[model samples]
Target: MKLKQITEVRYITRDWDRSTVKRVVKKLTNGKFVRKNSGPNTFYYNVPDIEYALDNLNVQFGEPATKGHYRTSQGDAAYYIWVVSGWKFKLSAMDMKLEVWPSGDISDKHNHFRDRYDR
Candidate 1:
């Protein structure tokens, strides 16, 4: 829970580490960079459903440093980025568009992204 400025407490995942968060965020470069494509170009969902995804992100990773967030239409997607530990966290919302690095060990994340955001 957020405490006084002198002593704020944040509940994070068991494996959560600031360095890990930074590392992962850096891999994306930013919200628009992807290395390899694995899923369909885009998946359309209701706005509330996508919003639930956003809420679930907060529950999973604590709150991120909310950055630019804008939604156009249901099918017309836009990024809702967040900065955590000085890194741009692009995968917070399922609306995220990511390209996985073929040589990296982040295939699981890619799969999770596809599963959650896929129709």
Candidate 2:
């Protein structure tokens, strides 16, 4: 599916604690919302399409996103800047705009959807 067409996707937030990561996975991959199987831990939720979307997005926008650091650095500095350069993106659902945050966290505020929707 096109990222722009995913207008009302679920926003799965974790519990903040370490176990929250697991909870967030459950929130995103629960069988109630996806396909069901016999054993609780035996099944897996597969979303190859999401991976495809991310790959396409990175290919389309990754170089442009890293150009800022490329132009600033001459030699060795460029190598250092490359460490975290893969975290940039142009979220199609979030207005098809460039977003550059230190952490790779995508919050509702970053998408400008705070006022329009519940977080």
Candidate 3:
């Protein structure tokens, strides 16, 4: 999607990490850069097609903490593997997006990103 498509944005006006929030917005909006506006002190970005993202990706909340979280062990195992496999993640009210790497490199960045939001 084009970068300027992100139109609607929402955020809590408490103390938050600026760069991390922007990164999440950019990812959710398909890499579009987010800018701040003054009128009421809001930080917003563009999503070329929010419907497409909402419709296409398999958005999910907290990982299945246990086997009960998944319908089957296979699913749970897969989820566990994916979580530990070092994918950069950003979670929103919508779903979680993993910044997958070409070589499948899982690193501390994933945890750092997760820690920023999963308080």
Candidate 4:
């Protein structure tokens, strides 16, 4: 299937236009790219694509994910920054985005997503 024309990815934000989401999805893999209701409209993507994101995001992706050091990089299209919020976060490739704060484990790296959608 063409990644650019995905329907599985669901966004609850107003700024996430169809073309914008499609453009971002085209660059990502593993199928589900979710947009949050708050926090700069960060487009939460797949962690499996972390390597591709890190290598291509113009920064070290895995290091921050495992070591818990926040990292970010500028993207080319439909996105502003590609991020691996290494700060007290964890990997979450759920069938649906978790609406609750699962835990207060600061060391858990509760943030693990790839980009901030361009607005």
lDDT of 2 by residue, 1-119 (tens): 33332211223233133233223333332212133432332222333333453444443333333322223233322211111221322222212122222333355546555556764
lDDT of each: 0.38, 0.30, 0.34, 0.33
lDDT of 3 by residue, 1-119 (tens): 43332222223333234454454445554634343331222343344654544332323213422222334543431121112122223213222232222223335555566678878
Per-residue C-alpha lDDT of model 1 across residues 1-119, encoded as one tens digit per residue: 32121111133423334444433433222233232432232212223344544554455446644444455665444455443322333432445443222222244555666678776
Q: lDDT score, residue 9, model 3?
A: 23
What TM-score do all the candidates reach, one by one? 0.29, 0.17, 0.29, 0.26
Give the TM-score comparing model 2 with the true structure, all chains together. 0.17
Question: What ranking of all candidate models by lDDT puts the best one first?
Answer: 1, 3, 4, 2
**Angstrom error at residue 90, model 3:** 16
Cα-lDDT of candidate 2: 0.30
10 residues in a row with least lDDT, candidate 1: 1-10
Candidate number of the best lDDT:
1
Instruction: lDDT winner between 1 and 4, please give it.
Output: 1
Candidate 2: worst 10 consecutive residues by lDDT? 77-86
